[model samples]
Target: MKSESKSQHVGKVTHHELKQTLGTWQLWGIAVGLVISGEYFGWSYGWASAGTLGFVITAVFIAAMYTTFIFSFTELTTSIPHAGGPFAYARHAFGPTGGYLAGAATLVEFVFAPPAIALAIGAYLHVQFPGLEPKHAAMGAYLVFMALNIVGVQIAAAFELCVTLLAIFELLVFMGVVSPGFQWSNFTKGGWSGADTFSMGSFHGMFAAIPFAIWFFLAIEGVAMAAEEAKNPKRSIPIAYVAGILTLVVLAIGVMVFAGAAGDWTKLSNINDPLPQAMKFIVGEHSGWMHMLVWLGLFGLVASFHGIILGYSRQIFALARAGYLPEWLSKVHPRFKTPHRAIIAGGVVGIAAIYSDELIQFGGQTLTANIVTMSVFGAIVMYIISMLSLFKLRRSDPNMERPFRAPLFPFFPAFALVAAVICLATMVYFNFLVAIVFAIFLALGYVYFLLTRHQRETAPTDALLEE
Candidate 1:
């Protein structure tokens, strides 16, 4: 933990491993999951009765808005796709304070998401095996993933490759059932009755759905966190970014269309594992045993959780090395060559979330879910800021080397910025209260940085000042 000379890599930044371990395919597997449609569980806001058009509008808006945001991230990530992701980018573009807020939000978001995914795994497992206790299922899944992450990235990547394949297979199987039983009338009429309409009673309900829908599409940028591990970052990073989004877009459309046509879309509303339930109705238990579908879906959950923990730990490592947080957190296990401190820290947060769910009577699931939602909004805010940073950096350092340039330059980034703003505007529309929560989170991070200014003396921060 000793400080290095300013001329040295004081951030404890070391290219300690070969980049060949991560290629375009591995990176995409780690970032995108075929079953992330679980995110849309709560998407049924009071708009469904507005008919098929409303569903399509929500679906297309999410897809387009998210793609634009990912494009903006592609530029930042390719430039400095080191471990910290946004934390690193914000530091370079806007200095320490900006870095701290973005890093803090990213850390909280990552830490919370892993357990949430674990819980999701439990939900699916319970649906699949009615005898399994929900809490036990959750803890068992968490324990399994905890080990998977600690075993080292090589093992994690291999596990990712396997589960990703399973995910794709399961998606195709579900698609097969849905395609043949497809009833276009189910989608065209009465499919959206349960959602909130634009009326006064359900205005907030409708507003809340925007952030939830947007949340499903926000984490694709996480693939860039592995830039330091990518075989050829300049080529692999952009491919991973764009490719991940494309995969998600196709999967999302498939799920939405099938879900709409196969069942009363109203029933699918607000349920976490709507696909399996919909599948049961579409193909009946005989086509695929209900047990098999449920377990397969749980496997997808585990795959996503594993990837999430890996991506998030690197963000923590980047923040630690840059001196915004404790230096020990920057350390990598010498043998495993992974961010050990960040991994453990992420585990603790995951455990805390489990306890919070157990101890709170005020609907911990709902609250935790909302907190995660707020985290998603926090990401949107940072994205909007980051997109602006892209324009500013291009103007300020036009001469800087960019190994992978964003296509169409300012136009694409500008379009992304506008989409990000629309996301924020939607957040404000849906729940000003959640917007306030994100604002408070940002303010607290800034204040904590002020209180921690003394730690800067011996802390490594060269990365913050890097060109």
Candidate 2:
């Protein structure tokens, strides 16, 4: 409940004793799983601002950014592989204050993402079985996945690998199933709603759509946080990172193109359960296979819901362990060898976020838009800082060993940083209210850290451990 200055050497006193249980493919599962839901739901939001073709253009542009950024990012993760992800890198490159900001921003990103995903999972469930309520389903998912993560990293990674593969397979099935009815005509008719097709309005819409387009690849960098748990962090991390981004890129293009081609792309856009809605075309609305596909698609959301819980917990543990957050948040469950306290803390936040709109009555606007915009805000912040760390470390720590060097050095990372900042600006321009709320949260965290920069780490941490 108190604040403390970050440890002089991050992780020097309270070493992260996480069990190294992940392999390359398993790590890839975490990366892809953390992002699989993006393909299922949020990307459709892009269609609101841009037409089918516009969204495609947005996706292709963002894909190129991620492709460049990930290559440069992997070099950092491989060189300084740690559970802190951006937190650790920022600490090494930008000192403790910078480290705190990076960790806070990452925490914001990972922590906020799951609630949106949990809502999606609930929507998927409700879409399939009308008897089940979305809120109840979302709450239940948080409980199940948190327990799975606490069970064991190896077990969770294996489970994530299975579900992620299932999600990917489902995308392929969707493409095959929908290819028959594909009409390029459907992609354009009434597709560019709410915006002029060839005017300044379309350009504005394209800019507005950028965040949702980035959703397809967002949080894929989360795999780097699992570096501390990978069997061979050096060799395995690069393979997993590279492969994961490539997989998502292919799936993003495939799902968007075919789904829009199958029917009025607008129907799928701006909805929580776009995948299942689109699949209604192949099988009639009430058909048994339609229900089956709807149920199967839940795996995509589950993969993300589960994987991101894993990610945020690690980030939480790393932050608390380094004294940037509550000391107890770093306490590991003795038997489970997992950061149970951190997992529970994040779960509590996520569930609360699931009901934020109802709790506060944010007028008539659904909380998902606010939540997604806020999460993307956090992501853009981390992306900028992480790219900065790559350049800083190259100049500051010349001896750092990078198993995988980014092919085009400064150009790729520099480009990613500039593009990400512009994306941040666009999201803020469109979603100023969400950005204001997010800034308030960040300011509150800073105040806590400033006030409690002198707490005794051991006494406080031990007290919580005993609880």
Residues 268-387 of candidate 1: C-alpha lDDT, one tens digit per residue: 665666777778776686664555666676656776778877878888777767666777887877777788777788777776666675332243336447555665776777777677
Name the runs in model 1 displaced over 4 angstroms.
Answer: 1-20, 34-52, 128-132, 191-207, 286-289, 358-365, 461-465
lDDT per residue for candidate 2 within 1-467, as digits (tens), equals 31233223233345447888789999999989999899988888889878887777788889988999999899988887788899888877876567778888999999989988888778767866899999889999999999999988899999999999999998998888788888988877655544435566677778889988988988998997788889998899989988999999999999988888888777787677776678787666887766767778888989998999999999998888766777788778888788888899999999998877765335344777667777888999999999998898889888777788988878999989998888888877887777777788889988886766564243223111111
CA lDDT for candidate 2: 0.82
Q: How many pairs collide in each candidate, listed in order?
A: 9, 2
Candidate 2 residue 30 C-alpha distance from true site, Å: 0.6
Report the number of the highest-lDDT candidate: 2
State how far residue 377 of model 1 sits from its true place (Å).
1.9
Worst 10 residues of 1 by lDDT: 1-10
Q: Clashing pairs in model 2?
A: 3-452, 4-452
What's the true lDDT of residue 181 in model 2?
85
Report, for every candidate in turn, its global Cα lDDT versus the true structure: 0.67, 0.82
lDDT of 2 at 277: 78
The estimated TM-scores of all candidates read: 0.88, 0.92
